[model samples]
Target: MSEWDAEFEVESESDEDPDFGPHGDARIDHAVASGTFTLDGQTFDVENNIWVVGDDAECVVIDAPHDVTEILEVIANRRVIAILCTHGHDDHVRYAPDLGLATDARVLLHPDDLPVWRLTHRAPPSGSLHDHQVIPIADVDLRVIHTPGHTPGSVCFYAEEFPGYPAGVVFTGDTLFEGGPGATGRSFSDHDQILESIRTKLLTLPDATVVKTGHGPDTTIGAERDNV
Candidate 1:
């Protein structure tokens, strides 16, 4: 087993109901769960959000944190088409390979983060995500926005009028958070780059755009625009 398998634990499971929208095409169900893991002797909490779009039987998974069991349970009976990582952080991607294998789903990451991914995962991802790339999951088309800084390959997935989200939703991995942009104290992290990313890529979105962060509660593009 990889060190990831031995070091992480599913601390809890909390299921939130999917937000329903007006049109059937916009009706996407989603659930969020969290897991805990230790890296370099420090414990970190990670959140994994699963989105069920189109036929409701097919789905896309974002940020494969620890607790594969919980993630599996959340996606039970559904066919996962893709596993999209926001970046290459171990805390966010530790279970991606196993989860992808279990679901036979394609794993995707930014090419710039391949080195970070190689630090923990032995195999390369199924593909690479680039700016403005559109990922079709069921009836939804998630637009990839490459927001570097937190990591060279950090990205955020954006979809408009998704389910209960009228304005839109952006799955911001560790790049942009509720309070401010993600930390830049680690290797390959740049404060200026992250700030510029937030300004040009994220903050430019509509004010009401929902910011589904990788680790905490959601925020809006407007809320963090001032901070940026």
Candidate 2:
């Protein structure tokens, strides 16, 4: 067995919740680590869901929030490959530099959102993510689906038949949610563009595909498809 497999075997046997999802050779575990902080005089409750999707000792991080210490603790000894920002939102991208510095991971963001990203972040990302870009992590591949609306560069990460996750998973930043699409009242947001992006990019996925949002509880594509 591989080092990761050995670690998982010993850890899974004793751990009940295991911070894992699905169940099979390809195990993808996630922990929803949240933090409540005041940003721009507004008290924002951020739910940062960090996913560890791979079999090897190395892994990838999706969306770095303010509470990075918790995320780092959850990751434990695994090597973090990259820190992918779903959008340029300050709430989501804050502390990304700290996390990157701590983990020695590359930070990635969409090109269009750089302006908004710069509002809160001073340093540039290690790289930029484009539409249909595939990010490989051991046995899993996270497909980047650009769903601009919440922001000009907002993107979602999609994975098909990811080990323990059979229906697949989509890490939707602020582009989508349970009740409806993400809010577009901000300066760079557009309502029509967001609706179209969801209809074309997200709703097209299989009904069972899991919708993992940047905040709040998780939902399935089927549950929000008709609403879109």
Candidate with maximal TM-score: 2
- Per-residue alpha-carbon lDDT of model 1 for 81-120, expressed as tens digits? 6788999988778888999999998687888999889877
RMSD of 1: 9.5
Candidate 2: the clashing residue pairs are 22-164, 23-164
What TM-score would each prediction reach against the true structure? 0.82, 0.83
Off by over 4 Å in 2: 1-25, 36-43
On the 0 to 100 scale, the lDDT of residue 87 in model 1 is 91
- What is the Cα-based TM-score of model 1? 0.82
